[model samples]
Target chain A: MSDADRVKVPRPVARFDDVTRRFDGGLVALDRVSLSVHEGEFVSVVGPSGCGKSTLLSLLAGLTAPDAGRVWRRDARPGEVGMVFQEATLMPWADVRANVMLPLTLLGEPRGACARRADEALARVGLDGFAHARPFELSGGMRMRAAIARALVTRPRLLLLDEPFGALDEMTREAMNDQLLDLWASSGLTCVFVTHSLYEAVYLSTRVVLMSPRPGRIQAEHRVDWPYPRGEAFRADPSFTHLRSALSVRLREDAVTPEGGAGP
Target chain B: MNGASGRAYLRWLAPLALAVAVVVLWEVLVHVFAVPVYRLPAPSAIALALYDGHSTLLESAWHTLSLALIAFVLAVAGGILLAIAFTRSRLVEAALYPYAVVLQVTPVVAIAPLILIWVGLDNAPLAVVILAWVVAFFPVLSNMTLGLRAVDPGLRALFRLYGAGAWQELRLLRLPASLPYLLSAMKVSAGLSLVGVVVAEFVAGAGTSPGLAWRILEAGNRLQTPRMFAALVLLAAIGVALFIALSCLERRVLSRWHESRR
Candidate 1:
């Protein structure tokens, strides 16, 4: 491509500088890991288990400080960022509306404002009718949607998702992928998704990052220049499967190392 | 649905039927054998005693019930506050938790005389309430501590991500999450508070306001076994009432959220 036709890179929203993390049992999670996510980019991290993919997201979300390196962000304060965990991570005592209001309430926002924001968020996730339902009373997919609504209530500029849809079946997972993309497009939020599925990473990410086994280090980075509003047909495209296979090969190579992958 | 309702009816009816049968059998045996009133009062004689000594028994019961309730309220408040303190600071927990354990392990009856002497006769009920509070406090403290610590790590991380301060964390997350544990502890302490107050009253000896325990002792000393039996019935009723009340509260609070209640 000519220099004039080259893609423009957005300013980095977050940067990790050689972050290292170690546990008490002499387990190294991340070692000298360096990466950056640009503004409004959908970055998916795919790796084998125990490869510190979740740890990277945690650092970016500022849930845990790195043991060694610095995690730099673009002036994102606590309420300016949102997170969705693997499980819903909802308070069982609270209903859907109350759960969505959690972040705003914690910020000590006025009740009327918090309630309005929560209602708006729930409606955005298509969960308006289920706002009064308890978390346990909802189906798994519905619960996850509520969780996403909770993550979005703060109107966060950055959203961190750790395997947010890993538990859903294929159909539901695909539907959620579309929904997530719609949400991401409309809000223009920077997102970092951690997952084990290569297809999922290829399907949703503007860029896919691969990491090696334990003491996770960034192995490779691939960019997908697919246009916005990618439909179901994209999953059937030869290019989609081609990219997934390339990413899968990178994962398998590290998974079957001299020492087997992380224990079940 | 009809079968389920039948089963529910039986659940209540079975115990009541057995209690009636036992009372009937006891009455028959006492009347047939002509057992001494002091040794074992007949069910009819006990019923008569209940009717005759209604005022005295009720007044003493009210005193004991009020004391136990006061202690229970105090215990809930103190235990929850201490538990919050413990969760916030490990240093405070490390220094004070052992002493709380000591208080729990020490027998209230053994210390009742000293408590009465220290607090004086006019405030004997207060001393009894304090003793009941000691018995009731540990369960709440320990349960609340466990509940606070048992918060899901994922949820805790989410709270931290939102910049929830310690106080907000406790109020919005820890306290609500710990409701089941706290309720269960309250149920346990409800019974223990009654036991502590009765034992303390017995140890405190007869003050101006004789509580249920003191009345029971007076009846036993006078060989009014029927009156003593009536007093025992009142004590049992109080315990059952408190247990049922707390259990209902627990169910009402937790049925919507807690798996156990559901």
Candidate 2:
């Protein structure tokens, strides 16, 4: 199809139309948040610690439903959507391959096919040689890589990651960012990543949506026009620094407001 | 073969040495005090009794062991199935868990006579198995229930995200997570099953079948203290064997990832 035809096609991988979620005791986790993610887009959500980024991902995963407004998922079914938690969340009793095979096994795929797909996923995550190793035997980063493999093994069209590298050190996090970018480039998956790091958001996301605290609502959306295969040089680039500081200033302004509210 | 085996050898050898010392001291005390055989038999006398009554004691031991094994198998099935039911349904658990607690707290000795009358004398061993099952069932149920509910929240959410069915969740996630708990409870129940069988046998008396407990009672009535000690030794041996066997099984299943095994 031509670019115009593709543009005319009403295809949205996910759409949040004025969604609001309120907890039992009147804590509003999200309020009137609206966003749309297209196919193969990398969207990063950045906010303060309690700004409902994880909750947004959970809503998208269908683990939780929005209390008000419509959340539309037009891309894939639950089994075709993959998610990574803040923690690695691996089954320690199972080895790397078995952990990665979990989704396929639950899907009732044949054993040999599950094993083959798990192997491929593990290899994609650079864990080919460690397929038989137990989760506890692997390092933290390796464990997270195994978890990523598990998410990818189902061949999901949409991948949701909730602060997956939050616990890692700076060096490992940077390496994982590059690895994740490479995977995204190859797989063409529409990814929604939630993180607190502005630098990470600028480095990895096509569009970064800033969220405000205390009833998380979209504050501002920043579009990063950086080209693919952005290397360490992009991190040192003046534009990268300027964007990071700009987002950081907005977050600082949000923090200074005494009522746990956001500035316009 | 070298240092590790040498250390392992010493580990058991130390306990064996202590047991030998205790036996020698008991022998010396009996001989020096000229104690009557009726009151307390010497280790030598117990050994001789074992030799003389080997066939009868062995037969009785086998009878008791068979009953315990039957009870153990039944208890395992009942406990695991019931625990699964409890985890799956709040209504079932609310209605029935109290009765399970009653079974746990009520002594098997207090119920063995009733079981005997209910099962009849022809099925005395079967009666013993029921009582043994009562004693052995609760640990597995409680431990497994806790294990099933103890699944990591994040992992549980992942399972939910994949839209895994209830059976799939149990089989692929809950069951594997609970193996450590189940194995630990099984180890505890192994010895309890044997004890329950023996106690039930004692209460039921020597009806249509004889067991090691009956042998002990008969020997005691006849004032054959040495023979009584031999029967007691056989019972202790069975308990030890059950414990060792179950422990080996637990280690095999749990050494990979369980914190306790590690």
Candidate 3:
């Protein structure tokens, strides 16, 4: 099926109620932060560095529990979760296929099944032929591609991404953004991605959530009413420019806030 | 590059040539000095002595080598057990460890006489040989334990999170990591084992079912200098052979998984 036809199947998803997470010894990392992610939605969370954005993704991935908060997969959707860490974090000693197949291996899935799924995922990330190569052999962008492939191989109901391309060069980052958009659109996966990139947030996201600092809370949300299966043409559009500028202004305001009290 | 390669060749060839040259010189020097055949024997004279007394020399070598082998095994086994107990409980390490240290540091020369006196005759010297084994063992056991315990806490936590039990983690990861340290200890201890065997033999040889040390002394008393040198050469050969064998063993076992092999 063509990419345009793929985005129509899985409708958007949302989470009800707030998420509050507090650490021991009276440190609150998240305070009543609530966000909804519809199926086939490409949402970006743009905020100050310690805005509990990554923590929010971690909670969605079931990696960390939120104190006094409940998370949901939204009714009527078959649920599965995938997470990509900020760093590629591929197993150094293992090759790309082996690294991507780790979760499947851990889950005790047969080697042949994991191999096929891994190959398909690698192809989805445009990394089909680089399967047997070790992580050290790959460049930064390729490593992140492998990490993304690993996350997507499970074909989960929800995809949680935290700055997956933050370490790449500008050229590579833009290319990865297009690829990710294509993947999300075609797979109809709900993605709640955390990023500090204003242009990336505005360009790739269907909805953008700007967050405030310490005991992180949502500051603002913007919806991008653009066509799906976006390409380089969309990146040049006036609407993209306007959204980026507005998001930049809010981020700057949060940054210069003297109290430094709202984020992280 | 030429110099380095030549130097590498010279490292082996030079020593071998020197050995041959020394034998020739000794053979010629005795005739030139008119040194009494008894007082300062020539290389030929020692060869003659060995030929004449071949049975006795070979028998003594067997005795000494067997003693060294047996004592070395006992020392390694007992020391490893003691080390495990010591490492497991800090209080035990603190408690019974003074003796391990005393055993390691105290000169075998001083203790051989006492050990001989306490154990008295029959196998006392063999027991003394085991003292050398004990001396050789602690460094390996201590170093290996340290290496085993030195696994990264991050990896440890990851393995724990993955549900790897203690034995599985140790067998799969900890043991391999600690191997280099253990092999290094074995290299030193292998040489030490030979030294311990000889020293124990030297002190205890005069008393009874003697080893090569007694043969050396008996030959020396009769001014059988070549015989004495022959025995020393045999002992040196044994030590070299043991060292090489152990080094090969260490390399073979570790090369499969370790950086050293790579």
Q: Which candidate wins on TM-score? A: 1
Better of 1 and 2 by DockQ: 1
Decide which is better by TM-score, 2 or 3: 2
lDDT (Cα, 0-100) at A26 in candidate 3? 62
Once superposed on the true structure, which residue ranges of model 1 sit more than 4 Å away at CA? A1-7, A260-264, B259-262
lDDT preference between candidates 2 and 3, better one: 2
Off by over 4 Å in 2: A5-11, A24-26, A259-264, B1-10, B258-262
Indicate the residue-level lDDT of B11 in model 1: 89
lDDT per model vs. reference:
0.91, 0.91, 0.75
- Give the per-residue lDDT of model 3 (tens digit) for B1-262: 9998899899889999999999899889888989987677888877887788788888888877777777667666665666556556789888888877887888887787777777777776656566667666777667766767776553443344234556656655566556767777777777787778778777766758567888888888877788897787778878888788888988887654334452
**What tens-digit string does per-residue lDDT give for candidate 2 at A136-219?**
788889999999999999999999999999999999999999999999999989899999999999999999999988888888
Candidate 3 residues lying further than 4 Å off, grouped into runs, are A1-16, A74-79, A258-264, B1-262
Docking class of 2: medium
Q: Name the Cα RMSD for model 2.
A: 2.8
lDDT of 3 at B163: 46
State model 3's lDDT: 0.75
Candidate with best DockQ: 1
